[model samples]
Target: MDALVGFTGPPSETLLRSMIATLMHRGKAPGEVFLQSNHASLARLQLSDDHAVGLRLDRRGLIDGDVTLLVCGFLTRDGTESPGGSVALSGLIAEYRARGVAALARLQGAAIVAIADETAGALHVARIGAGVRTVFYGRYTDPSAATSRWLVASEPKAITSAPAFQAAIRPAAIAQYLAFSFVPGSGTMLQDVFELPAGHAVTLSADGSSNLTNLFPFEDGEWDGRGDGDDHSHWVAESRRVIADAVARRLPVGEPVGIFLSGGLDSSIVAAEVARQHNHRVLTYAIHFGKHYPNELQFARSVADRLGTEHHEVMVNPRQFAPRLRQMIWHLDDPIGDPITQPNFELARRVSQDVRYVFNGEGGDPLFGGPKNLPMMMQHWYGVPREPGFREKAYLASYRRAYEEWSRVLHPRIRDQIDPERDLESILAPFFQQTSVRSFLNKLMAINIRLKGAHLILPKVERMLAASGLTPLAPLFDEELIRLSFQMPPRMKLRSGDEKWVLKRAYEDDLPREVIERPKSGMRVPVHFWFRGEMRRLAKKTLASRHVREAELFDPDRIRQLLRYDIEEGAGRYGMRLWMLMTFELWRRVVVDRDRTGVSGGR
Candidate 1:
């Protein structure tokens, strides 16, 4: 969770310090700032002393005469000493020095790199690989100066710290967030602020002009050739080898590592691989919502027992963490309406005490087909009058978040500004329309990996774990595994009615039969019961508050109707909608309203 913040403008120590202050939670160590006549860059180092071997190389940046390089996450290469630190920085610098920005495409692992070239009068920022790491940039114009300044950081809050940067809410993004539970593309909830997508780069010039480029486009069908043969065993063997290698690359040296085991196929696969390779102890953590709600602990325990891992099961409920809601939202930076956000944060808090690194099975569903793809596939083949945008609409509805209720939930003023076609469907249009990816399933996988995996799943996990001072290692999300998924045929991903078929076949012997055979009932957070029980009062008070009404973003009457479960259809499903509303309001207080007092004691 170390961060980098910089701007293209006349050097001002105060401006740089202010931005760093907002991100102090990311790292308590004093920030190191590099300044020149027209640019300033700051790095907030957060790694503990035990992991500081590479601090000297790029903790601030690898500075050459006219060019300086800064990286916020680890980078890896074949036979590199480690995934990150001095060796990685040395390798990265060499590549950049030789190939310039093109070197970023050759880079692997999860990282965001920034190269500032004083001679070229340009600053380039790129997110490497599968977008496990995030970088946000926004343009801020100083009233006193003629030229606009571009502000960039690891999180959006840093950009908002500048006084001149306006943080107006983008209604269309909110609509998208409701549909996907997270904003889909580069656009965030803020108007001017944008997230750099995976395999994309942006360059900022002195004159305030910027150009965005897609560095590695997944839609290009480059990986299709890998799965060209009809021999299924070859793919299964190749998948097993590639996945093992991915996990091996991520295993920490001389230290215990933890896995967020849900007893699901993804986490189990990761755990089995880690246990197979690591010399150190393997710890697995699972969560349940007390005995009142259905739990996955049985399956998780079975896997843990099979692997002989030191398993720990924790129970999280609304009553225990409600007071920290605002603090959690603050950590999220962007609102993610998924109910599991709190549980992820809580689990990280526990895991942080035992290990600095944690691994999870995050990419399996998105990379290979998962259950969510089934409904869309069914609609694609069987039910539907063929119509334009049918795929987009069906995909949006599959999330089952707030998409159907977005318009009803938003105030008319907010709704008036949003056009679903321009804002919502447009994001998915390019992927669906791209003929380069021949299979419809692969196209869905493209959207899932690029949009959901990059934006929602990876960012949410990274932020929550980073809050607890832990780094997440997603072996499944490795760049190699991502390409492998695309290379393998669509049927290899989802065969007959089974999802992630190849993944299951790859680890069939390594994992328990029950774990592999069971349908993926994901870590289901009991939001419905919480709204009727523990979180009921809190939801009622927050949504009905004057501040929410004054903000003119949500319809108060609709919120009340949702709270009361007054709607005839989808009655019990209002918990997610309410959670999204509450998360946005709390986020508004911290980021938009700048209400520091409201952030503490989240009641």
Candidate 2:
């Protein structure tokens, strides 16, 4: 968590010291600076004194005036023995210049780097592929030109201040965030601030006067393994190999590594792999809401027993759920609409008390079609979507929703885009512009990867652990694993009614047939029922308050109606939409409002 800020203005020893001190808590080293203004200004904090490469580079920053880069790397609990030279900062410095953009092409670990040119004042900023590391930039307003200097940091809360930062929340992004509960791609919750897209970088000139130059581009459907005879079976084998490799790379140090085992196929498979490689059994953790939740204790226990891993199960009640909500929101740094965010936050906190690292299954769905929507997608693709009245049925469910709800949950624009009278096939045509089923599936995968896949997993789990100063790993998100998943044939990934078939096939030898055959039991938090039951009073008060009504972001009347009305017969998927909206309002109140007071600036 090291931060370096260099100003082109005349050097001020005292001011520089104060700026370095800003990063003191975030870093392990005492804050210090070396100024040769005409040369380059450098402030360095080596979060880990053991990792001395940062100290060496901090020295170079003072002498070299061509390019200035600030890098911060976080080692999860499991990363203690990451092979001596794997994370060397000097190698990264050399890679940037020698290998150019390719230097980070195969890089691992959670890290963010900002490279600045002292002479030319050019900056190249990026994060690791899965965005386990975060880098955000805001334009510092300057009057000399129509532009401002680009300020970048590791987190949004860090740079959302400085008088120069604009707090305009991107509207389109807000809609997507509501739908996905996480912002996708390079966009951030704030309008001016942007997360450097994963596996990508941007180059900006020193004077802060230049259009963004994308150093990495999103390339999909580019898997060429097919020509090499790596068909579906080959891909299944490769998937297993990559999963093992990724897990081995992130196993815990000192203590046993922890796993967020849900007893579902995803985490079960991950736990099995960890058990196979290491002597110590992986410690699997789960937060349960008694029997009302996923009822995963029995299953998770069974897997742990079979693999001889020690399992810790904590049953959670409402008392444990309340206090952690704020902490979770703080780490997520974004409006996370899901109720499970609370549980995941608590799970990380509990794990952080003892374990430094935990591995979970996050990206399994998007890459391998493990989500329920896949069946819908498959049904639509084969012509059932063309049947009359399907769209009508979906839409009527929304209208039939209880009047207690105020606004309809569906995005108004998405709803308008779909003709109310049209069939499901016609409704989906716009989202999937491609006619080919495989191509459309890929596009769907891309959306999930951008939003639901990484969005749900990283922000909730990774960010939660980060808030607690712990490290969490998602093996399903490994770049090679994702590429391999794409290489698998559709049938292997999703057959008849079974999703994640390829994932199961990949680990057939390791897991019991019944474990692999079990239904996908998502971590449950009865938020839908809670909206109509125990939390109804709170929902009414929150939705009717001046904060929500006066803010006018969402229609108050509509919200009230939705909250009051019970959609017991099942309001189609209306609950998901309504829940998303409610979470956004809560986020605005908690995060966006406090952001206005100026405490959440510059990490």
Query: Backbone clashes per model, in order?
Result: 0, 22
What is the overall TM-score of model 2 with all chains considered together?
0.79
lDDT of each: 0.80, 0.57
Model 2 misplacement above 4 A: 1-65, 74-95, 98-103, 142-147, 163-166, 207-233, 292-294, 384-438, 454-456, 566-579, 595-603
lDDT per residue for candidate 1 within 1-603, as digits (tens), equals 577788786776777777777766654344454545445454545544324312223444677676777777766653344544344455666777788777777667667778887877888999988888888999887665555788888878788878666679888988998888899888898988989988888998888778877767655643555535567798899899888888877677688989999999999999999999888989999999999899999999999999999999999998888988888887788764888989988888888889878889999999889998999888778986567887788788888988888899889998999998888888999988888998888988899889998899988998888777677889888877777787777888889989999888889999989999999988888888888899999988877757667999988888778878898888767878888888888788777877765363221
Q: Give the best candidate by TM-score.
A: 1
- Per-residue error at 399 for model 2, in Å? 18
Residue 373 deviation, candidate 1, in Å?
0.4
Residue 210 of model 1 has an lDDT of: 83
Query: Any runs in candidate 1 off by more than 4 Å, and if so which?
Result: 27-37, 40-46, 49-60, 78-99, 143-147, 221-228, 598-603
